[model samples]
Target: MAGKSGRRSENRFIRYLILFTWALFCLMPILWFLSIGLRPRIEIITPQPIYWPSFSLDAWKMIWQDWPMAKYLFNSVAAIFGSVLIDLVLAIPAAYALSRFTFRGRDDIAFYILSTRMMAPAIVAIPIFFLFRNLGLLDTIYALMLVYAAINLSIVTWIIRSYMLDIPKELEDAARTDGAGDLRILWEIIIPAVLPGIITAAVIAMIFAINEFLFTLLIASTPNAYTMSVALANFTGGSDGVIYNAIALVSFIAMVPVFIVVLAIQKHLSRGLTMGAVKG
Candidate 1:
């Protein structure tokens, strides 16, 4: 018994050590960014890596005061939110129809939708730019919103459809037997059952939209439509070399929205990922 207890304790220690090591590895880059953002100009310019650096808020102050950080943040947040909203609005019904009802060319239609995403955005950017330009939507947040929504819609529908497929068909049959219509059953039964997947899909769409840089750069011809990613790029175009501290600060700030959003929805996110993973 003592030998078995000792072996179990050793195994637990090994498990914890592995987890700690992996977590540290994942966090090291963010920690490095934080250190760089807080360090003074001298410490940052030094070639040698400093183990411990003096801290200053000048980087943060410079970013907020000297740069149009607020405008960039607002544009980024609005575009992502709008895109996710549009994705959810369109995807939920489309996913339900694809998953629940049998129809002609259903699989073909789903594949066609996904195939749109398979084409590299770069290949189609010119035509899309021309279309939006003709519509006079160049350099607008709404244009970014529409572009991101179209980009994310296919994935969102597929994710929700997959989750809906996992649901037992008996629930729908029972609802039908109870005289509940399809829309009612969908709203009360299907949506509630797949809420986790919806949240997961929305979050994924938001992250993708936020990180999108190419289309944003092409569309944001002016500072008025600049996003966080574009603003960070603008910092590198300086004649006096790159501003390491400013770039670091912007990178860190860009992470804040995603971090806060994921943190706020951690329960749903973890459940969405894990709830069905260990099912019997």
Candidate 2:
């Protein structure tokens, strides 16, 4: 009994050590970035860095006053929200159809939808650019929002459909017997049942839209439509040269919204991801 107790304690110690190491690995960059953002340029550029650097808010001030940070942040929020809304509005019905209906070529259509994601964005970027340009939609937030929605539509449909399949048909059938149409059944029955999966899909879509760089860079030409990602990229080269501290501050600020969103919906995220893994 003593030997067994010793083995269990050793196992616990090893497990905790592994978890601590992994946490450090994940947190080290964020801590370093925060440290940089708080330090002055003099301390940041020194060959022998200060471990506990003196704090400064100059970077935050520079970003707020000089950079169009507010506009970029607003654009990022608007674009991501629009994309997620469009994705859900379109995906829910398509996913419901895919899940509940049995028409000819259904499998083929599903495969085709999923196949769109396999194409790299670069492969289609030029065509999309020209298409937007021809439509006189270049350099607009609407264009970016539409592109993001289309890009994420396939994955959202697939995820929501999987979750919808896990829902019992009996509930839908009972609703149908109560004189409910397909739309009513979906609105009343399936939507409530699969809401977690919808939330998961929306969160994933939001993250993708938020971090998207190439499309935004290629499409938006003015500050009016520039997102946080594009604003961060502009710091790469400037007339005054790159300021590492300022860049770090911008990076930290850019991540705040996504962090808040993940924290808010984490419970739903966990259940949503696993709920569709196995069908009932």
Candidate No. with top lDDT = 1
lDDT of 1 by residue, 13-125 (tens): 99999999999999999988998999886798889988889989988999999888999999999999999999999999999999988999999999998898899999989
Measured against the true structure, the TM-scores of the candidates, in listed sequence, are 0.94, 0.91
Residue clash pairs of candidate 2: none
- Relative to the true structure, candidate 2 reaches a TM of 0.91
Q: What is the alpha-carbon lDDT for the whole of candidate 2?
A: 0.90
Q: Total clashing residue pairs per candidate?
A: 0, 0
Give the runs in model 1 whose Cα sits over 4 Å from its true position: 1-11, 275-280
Worst 10 residues of 1 by lDDT: 271-280
On residues 116-208, what C-alpha lDDT tens digit does candidate 2 reach at each position? Answer: 999989999999999999999898889989999999999999989989888988999899999999999999899999999999999989888
